[model samples]
Target: MYRLHKFLWELRRNPELAERFRSDPDQTMRDYGLNEEEIRAIKGKEFRKLYQAGANPYILLFGAVHMGVPRQEYYERMRSQS
Candidate 1:
């Protein structure tokens, strides 16, 4: 989660950097400790599960970080209603 936070921070500060990383999924998986075969599995990994894993949660990062959506939006959209 901490790593995800840091990544989100980076994405927010410089989304171009995020795009560069995402551009090469190969390097990204390798950096995430996936072996060749494991990388292949990652290629098949569902995008939603990736968001759930939260290690390098790109979906949230993409919206909250890359899109520069105000924190208020996150609050309104994500705050627990219960």
Candidate 2:
């Protein structure tokens, strides 16, 4: 979880890394030590999975924003799951 947090943080702060993530999220997650499920969740843009896995909401928001998801759309998607 900590590693995922740090990995998200890096993706948020670094443009190059963010570009890499946008281009190939699975590979990026793999390079960052995320497990297959974690990689799948992120690569698939399954934020609900990440949240259920104990990811921080604030960071998840940042991730969603960084990935170009509209704020309202992200909120709606998350809300629908609850």
Candidate 3:
């Protein structure tokens, strides 16, 4: 979870890292040492799963936004999981 949070923080603050992630998410996630569950949640855009896994909602939303997911879509995805 710490690794996931760190990666999310970096993804939010570091434009270069975000671009690198956008280019090759699998590789970027692997490089971040994220486990399969974390990688899957992010790659699959499963925001609710991430939240359930204890990610801070604000960080998750910011990271999702950096990845081009709209705010409404993020909320929709989160609600759909309920």
Best prediction by TM-score: 3
How does model 1 fare in lDDT? 0.49
Write the number of the candidate with greater lDDT, choosing between 1 and 3.
Answer: 3
> TM-score for every candidate vs. truth?
0.36, 0.87, 0.94
Best by lDDT: 3
Listed per candidate, the RMSD to the true structure in angstroms reads 7.2, 1.4, 0.9
Off by over 4 Å in 3: none
Ranking by TM-score: 3, 2, 1
Clashes of each: 0, 0, 0
lDDT of each structure? Answer: 0.49, 0.83, 0.92
Lowest summed lDDT window (length 10), candidate 2: 73-82
Clashing pairs in 1: none
> After aligning candidate 1 to the native by TM-score, how far in Å is the CA of 9 from where it should be?
1.6
Give lDDT tens digits, candidate 1, residues 1-82.
4433454456556657557556886785456455565345334433244344554544453535353455555445445322
lDDT of 2 by residue, 1-82 (tens): 8878888888789999999888888888889998888887776668877898899999988978887887887788777754
